[model samples]
Target: MVLFAAGALLLGAGTTSRIFALTPENREAQATGPLTAYLEGQGENGAIWLKLRNGEVLKGRFEVKVGGSFGAYGKSRGIDRPGAAYEGSGRAIQGGSPAFVDMKGPSGATVHCEVVNDDANAHGSGVCLFSNGAEYWVLY
Candidate 1:
């Protein structure tokens, strides 16, 4: 009975890991879906604000420049610090939807944000997960 229980536990763990494993295609889909929605609403220039879980505030200005690239600068706590800019190029995903964006911050941190655009209410929220395990809730 003990051996059976142990085997069951191992099998369950393996299954959980497999289920949570993120492949490249899954990663792209996860990013692209929200990114495409956010950019479509942003037009040429837009502003976004993030309130970190730790009470830090980050304000970002986004610009869709020529060649289909995007750039952003974020100010935290009303202070403009060096290395707080983000820039990336936008690409279409499998269905030709503009959803994949590869952006890196000034500190070389990768920022992953998922946003839903709500123009009518003007109260859209999203989450930004950083490479350093820091997360922020974005309000746009």
Candidate 2:
């Protein structure tokens, strides 16, 4: 009886560990980005216009239809740089709440934004982790 009980306990512990183990799918799902979060909460039809830290303006329009997506177009005219067109796409990740966004911009730049506070309106804030080893505080 003692051996049987010990075996049962070991089996239970192993099962518990397996249940809580972080699988690849779970890891991907939990790794939501800020842009994804922002676009997800945009509802069926929503829009945002925000100013970047570099004084460039970004205007995004989100459409939840057609598999939930967002597109943005903007221009940056820095001190010496001529105005250049900037465009990007934000796609929502499946089964991600508060939304995880995968965003890709011009010149192959990408970032992930997770929407922490989504009022589902014209204003929101999130943290963006860029592909170029940079992070920024985003407000829209």
Candidate 3:
């Protein structure tokens, strides 16, 4: 009976370790870097926190606006699904607004992006598909 109990305990411990293991998804979410730097440039609000790779942090709030030439609100392009089943690529256009951080590249330089928007919008989930290439996220 003692031997059986010991086996069961080991199995349970292994299962728990697997459950707590670091995954790519979790790493990306926890790994702060360039994203945090850009957010710091934007300054403070109450809605979001930008964490830097070097251990600095910034806080900010963002509001979403839809109008004018900026795709008429709600209408957007290039959103990827979870599990990396879909993908798209584009170039960052230059513009000025609190909601968007401009991502620019050399002439004719295009980069890939995947949607990882986890926020929920009225239409559906807000998770965006993005890559580690040249791209920016609309934080709000």
Candidate 4:
């Protein structure tokens, strides 16, 4: 039985997957569907603030470039960093057309990201806020 349990853990199934959640409650949140979010804006170290359907929010630093390959930022595994990180990698599903997706995070933080074009750096000058309570800003 122990061997079977360990094998299950190796496969990253529902059982072991929960062990890796950012928080205990965050683990359960993973069961929810993939988070829906947008690109918001390009930030230093690729950080982005996602505005979600719910009133909650998600802020993280990433390494995504405008013309670089796409990364699956919405995954639970991508939240290892404190404020910002480059946690996901994949093809650009939305290309340069800009897209929004339902994003999920630790502690049931549901959020979204809307793409904005900002080429500034330092003193958090590379972000733009919207009336919808969403803002895309740089981490550094």
Rank candidates by lDDT, best first.
1, 2, 4, 3
lDDT for every model? 0.27, 0.27, 0.23, 0.26
Tens-place lDDT per residue, model 1, 1-140, is: 00000001112212211010111223433442222112212333343332333334333433322233212322222112222221111111111101112234444545554332222222233334556654443332
lDDT of 3 by residue, 26-133 (tens): 345435322422211112111323333444343333222222222211234423312321112222222221122122233322212222222222011112222342
Worst 10 residues of 1 by lDDT: 1-10
Tens-place lDDT digits, model 2, residues 88-107: 12322222113233445444
The alpha-carbon lDDT assigned to residue 132 of candidate 4 equals 37
| Model 4 clash tally, residue pairs | 18
- Give the per-residue Cα lDDT of candidate 3 at 29: 41
For model 1, the superposed segments whose C-alpha errors exceed 4 Å read 1-102
Worst 10 residues of 3 by lDDT: 1-10
lDDT tens digits by residue: candidate 4, 32-125 = 3223222222222333344433545655433323443222432232222222231123212222211122344455553332221122211111
Q: Note each model's CA RMSD in angstroms.
A: 18.8, 20.4, 17.6, 16.2
Alpha carbon deviation, residue 48, candidate 1 (Å): 7.2
lDDT of 3 at 81: 17
What would the TM-scores of all predictions be? 0.29, 0.31, 0.25, 0.23
